[model samples]
Target: MGCTTSRYATGKKKPVPIREIVVFVPSTRVPKEIDLRRPLRGSLSEGLLERLAALRAKVVALSEKWSLNCSTPTGNIATED
Candidate 1:
């Protein structure tokens, strides 16, 4: 008989150690081996407010689209007791 390669229609696997195992726990993680720098400009960041204001519409739209129920201390999202 000719030598046949391993693994056939019978779905048999050679005796080998299983390596694909992943365990995830909902626990906090700490940053490691990385560098983060501050803003390139000085303290008085120019045009930052305007840029954020421009994104407000998009953020609200996305929040409604995803049904996130996002609420903040703003007019449309916020409510007072």
Candidate 2:
């Protein structure tokens, strides 16, 4: 009998390479807290203000898109009073 080779592709031989990165932070450091309230004296820098506005817009958009009710607290999500 004669041997015939068919041109048919099989499963994926090489899978995607996933890298696990472990970051070890320093144990002790200066306590730096991010104050959410606006500056007492003057307005924040223009660049910072723009960034904060953009971030707020993104959050609102995401909440609307996923039908997430901000008032309803299901998990760790904060609810507005």
Q: How far does residue 33 in candidate 1 sit from its true spot (Å)? A: 39
* lDDT (Cα, tens digit) per residue for candidate 2, span 16-72: 332332334333322244443366226677677767767766765665644544334
Q: Which ten residues in a row have the lowest lDDT in candidate 2?
A: 21-30
Q: Each model's number of backbone clashes? A: 0, 0
What tens-digit string does per-residue lDDT give for candidate 1 at 1-81? 333343443555554333333343333332242212234235535576456545665665665644433332224433334
- For candidate 1, the lDDT comes to 0.42
Distance from true position, residue 29, model 1, in Å?
A: 27
Model 1: residues with Cα > 4 Å off, grouped in runs: 1-46, 68-81
The local distance difference test score of each candidate is: 0.42, 0.49
